[model samples]
Every structure is written in structure tokens, then in C-alpha cells.
Target: MRPARLSVVTATTVAVAALATVTGCTAKSDSTAGDGAVQVIAKDDACEVSKTEFPSGHVELAVENKGSKVTEVYLLFPDDRIVTERENIGPGTKAKITAEVKAGSYEIACKPGMKGKGIRQKVTVTGGTAAKRSPEMDAAVAAYRTYVQEQADETLPKVKVFTDAVRAGNIEAAKKAYAPSRIGWERTEPVAESFGDIDPKVDTRADGLEAGQKWTGWHRLEKELWQDKKLGADAKTLADELDKDLLDWQKRVGRAEITPTSMANGAKELLDEVASGKVTGEEERYSHTDLVDFKANVEGAEKSFELLKPVAQKNEPALVTELDKQFAALNTLLDKYRDGADSYEFTSYEKVTKAQRKELSDGVNALAEPLSKLAAAVVK
Candidate 1:
């Protein structure tokens, strides 16, 4: 019912297939043409932009991949909350992305191999009206933060259980704890991206990165524990690395800022992610935990929506009513996948039929349409 996030495994498909795009505050599957959108290229491990500077407000950057392999392009804030991204762009294709950026210094990243850090370009925006945020939006951010922190706090112990299993070379125990432990992290992923470095260390997959990028975290352990069924030295090291990073990350939570615009944008991005990764069954391919992340993303979006609801109810009661109905319908749909426990069963990625995927997609899109407009609707 709630949706997903950006990770390497899913992101590759995201670029070439359906990008996580924002339409107002909603997610739009199609490309949006900007009035004066500029062109950039992803070529042989570089992100080359048409210009280095621009006027702020509504800005569009059109990226084309001339590279031989798949690639991704992102407009990143200093904290690494992606302004907009076009992932999975294959050779000879292009992706058009637009964002509302205020005058400031920003970073442009072109992941040439769609792995690791691609080339980065620094750009400056000249002029634009400052975004006005309200207490309603602030409350939404605060609520989401509390939820994220709680998730992380609860997750640390579970992860220790998992890592301890891996450390002790207990593959059976490690496998059992995997998906459930990840749910805590996956739920708050929209906020997690702001942590930048920690995200990759904790979750990158082998196939998710460009050539030669080191894969680590849960998926790395997933391979040894599930695929190899042998937790070796490298596997233990990865588990230990994840152990330290998760603890350090919790310490950084209070320092991050979650604004109304980002929360609104994150809601749409989460659903867009569902369409790209979870529905396609590209994410958690090895672990078959796509459904787990999918549910968490939805829950995260709901937290964002709940915080914004009072504003919506005052401004547009009809829209609020519609959102409530759609969210319930979607959640009802997701609930069918529950494992009789608090978590979803998902069965297996391959077991999911085309009809099933479409059913989920259609439900998510229905909720997404009304969900996307919430931020701007409330702001107005």
C-alpha cells in the first residue's frame, strides 16, 4: 500500500525503463518537456552538461547516454536528497528530467556505469523565489523523522542478530532473519537517502553498480548465506561493516532536515519506485524481498500523507476523502500478501504472474495520482 525507494538493483531498470519522475507533487511515468531544458551526456564514465550555471526556479536537464553500458543521472542536493533522476538509461537513449531548484550550489551526478559514483559536476543556480514551508509541512517532517528514527533503533538489534549469525557462520539463522530486518530500513528509505554514504554501504548489490564497484551490506551477505550457502571471510567482513555503519547512521538522524516539499516529492518517488523496481521484480531479486521493501515504502508515504492530511482536509476535503479511499484500497490489496505475521510473505519474485504485477501497479497508480498533488495542494 505504501511504496519503495532508490537503490542500485532497482535503479538500473529505473533509468532505461520508467524513471522516478515528479508531476507537481505526484509521480508521472512519462517524460516531461521543459521550456528550455538543457542537454547532458553520460559517456564512458563521465557526466558532461551543456552548461555549468542557470537561473533557478523550474530547471530541466535532458540527459542522453552515449555510453556503451547502462547509466544514471541525478541532480543532488548537498545532503544527497535527489532532486530528480533518470536511471537505467541504456546505450543511445535519452531521459528528460525537471526540478524546481532555488538559487544555490548544487551537484550533478552521472553514474556512467550506473554504479558507484559516476562523474560529478558542480552547478550554480542564479535566481528564484524561496520555497515557503508551513508548520503543517514541518509537522509532517517531524512525524516522519520520529518514525524513521524508531525504525532504525528497532532495526539495529535485529541487524545485530543477523550479523551475529553471519559472524558465527550460522547460514540458516542468517537467512531467516534477512527480510524482516531489512523492513525497518526500507520503510524510511526516502529519508535515508539524505545520509548519502551510508545508503550504499548498507545496501548496494553486485549487479547494481557500474563495472568494478565493490558490493556490500545485506545483499553481499545474502549471496554468501543464500546463494553460496557459505559465510566466508569476505562475508563476515561485510556483515561487520554493516554493523558499524548502521550504528553510526542512527547517530546522524537528528541532523538531517526533511522539508514538506521533499516529503511530498518522496511520496511520489516511493510509488514511482514501486512501478520501476518492485512491480518489475528487479529489486531484491536474489533475496526475494521486493515485497518487503514495497510495503515499507507505502507505509513511509502514508506517514508523510498523514502529516499533510489536516492541511488537505481544511483546503480540499473532497481530495482528502478520495486519498483515504484509495490508500485503503491499495493497503487492502497489499495485505493479501502478508505472511500471517506483521510482514508480507511475497512467496517468490518469479512466482508472481504478469496479471498480479499489473493489478498492484494499477492500484498504486490510482493512489499515486491523488497522492502526488498533496504537497502543492496543501502549500497552496
Candidate 2:
């Protein structure tokens, strides 16, 4: 998920090189005989292709593996369409791919090492039968459409419940509601994991607190601010710090052009804030009220995703379907906490308990997994 943090190691470099090769293409060696013929080569640990434009119809792609490692190539069309795919092209191997296509734009993606950071080549198809359509393509389109509809029907209402519980300050209910909420955002784990260390200091507090007072992560922060009365000024200060940090985080998260390095830096910064006690102040007191509000914000995000899913799916089925899965997981995780918060009544933060904190952490992780995946899937 999140493209595995884009390491600078040989493996990661090779993968990125491949991706760069495929995605960055320019027209080369144009000819009438080569009109319908496209040549793809994997070179310098990347996939490279000749001919950026062609007339649509029956097309043949001559792909040569020039890289040391084996690679697989996929021809993906605009709007999440996959025309055809070939796999297991060993070094020095060459393969020919034939498919009936129409005038449009398509991408050549190469998968190396069985991982997704593949090379993509852009191709433009011109001058073909305007009405030529295939039954198989139609079927795939229909199936994708149905999958998106089902996802929306199943996940939206549950997301609302989880968010409502968090906004209500019902920590017990929030815990219980987190499970279903997690499922709703399962596909967006990469994004959520970036915020995983929202409040790491709570681990120690959770271990030291009474059976019902233990709290961790966001839940721990909530208890510190709203449940624990001993931390007055400290809690307020921590809340202010969190507000600032979260605002910065929101800006980074909302940006359309986020690089793996930028994402990693953001995560490190958040973790550092928690480790330095900047989020909770010198007294190390957490804030329950702040936690509730943060959770609510997370819930609102889920709702926004639910609304966007349909439109995205209609425009890009394959991509949006994957994204929906991530959102589903996130929604499920939130549902667990919401349910937990609703099922129990805690008069004080001390009554929150260790088991609850553990559950909340696990739920958050579950949600984080999918968000991370979605981010990685679209990073390029």
C-alpha cells in the first residue's frame, strides 16, 4: 500500500525506472507500414515503446523485453478499460499482441516483480470505425457498473452511524461502530496509515490505566481531553497543537500531486509531534473532546467518499472499484469504534478500559490498510 514508501533500494529504483519508461513516451519512427504496428521494449530496467500514435482497428503490438528481469504488460484504455494483457516476458523475449480497438487513448503498463509500480506508455488511436463495438467489452463495462452500485448500497448508511457516534462524544459507541466503518474504507489504507501515529504516547497510558481507564491512540486522546479531569490547561494546549498539526496534514492530504517522499515526510512529522509531546503538551495530557471532533472529521471524509464513488465509478470503473474497496474497509473500522462507544457508558475518561483501546487501535489499522492501498494505486 502507498507504493511501499518508494525506497531508494535497487528493487524500488528498478520499479520506478520501469514506471517512468512506460508512462513517459514520445512518437518515434512513424511509417505507413508501421501504422498498426507498435514496438515495446524494456530497457534500462524499464519498459519502452515505439510509436505513440496509430490508426484504430486490428492492432498488433510487438513487445521486446530488454530488461534483465521478467515483465508483464497491460494495455489499459481510457475510462479504466483493459484491452488486452500479456505476462511473463523473460529477458530478451519478444511477444506480439493483437486486439480490435477504436479511436481513443490507451496506456501500456508493465508489471515487473509481480508488483504494481509498472511502466506506462501512452498511445493514441486514430481513424477507425465510429460504431465498432464488442460484446465482451460491453459485458465488462456492465459488470463494473453493477459492482459500484452494490458498494454504495451496502456501505453509506453504516458510515453515517459511525460518524454520528463520534460526534456525539459517546466513546463507547464509537468503539463499537468502528468495525463496519473500517470496511467502508478498506481500500484507502495507505492514506489512513499516514496518520497512524496521531497519538502514540497513549500506549503507555493505556498500559498503566485501570481496567476501564486504559485508552490508546485517538481514543486515548479523547479520554485525555474529555474524560480525564486532571488535565485542564494541558489538555487545552494539546488540543490547540493537534488543531494546527491536523490543519497542516489536511492540506497535504487534499493535494492532487502528492509524491511518495512528501507523504513519508508528513507521516514522520506527525509521529515526531506525538513523540515530542507537542500534541499533548508537557503534562502529557490527552483530550477526549478533540478526539471526538477528529473522529467526526474522519467520518465526514467517509461520507464524502461515498458520494464520490458513483461518479468516479462511472468515469473510471476499474480505478474507482479499487478505491471503493478501500473506503469500505475504512468505514468498517470506524463502525467498530462507534458500536463500542454506543454499547457502554463511561462517566469518566478513566472508565474507558484497555481492551477498548486495543480494539480501537486494531480497527484504525484495518482502515489504514486499504486507504494506503488506494493511495499507492493512484500515486502515479
Which RMSD values do the candidates have, in order?
A: 8.1, 15.4
Per-candidate clash tally: 12, 97
Give per-residue CA lDDT, model 2, range 182-296, as digits (tens). Answer: 2322222223333323222222344333333323323344453345623333443443443444334334333222222223222222222222221123122343221232243
Question: In candidate 2, what residue range of length 10 has the lowest lDDT sum?
Answer: 1-10
Where does candidate 1 stray beyond 4 Å? 1-73, 78-103, 108-122, 126-130, 314-318, 344-346
| Candidate 1: tens digits of C-alpha lDDT, residues 135-213 | 7766777887787789889989999989998888888898878887787777767566665667767776665553545
Q: Which has the greatest lDDT?
A: 1
Predictions in order: lDDT: 0.70, 0.43
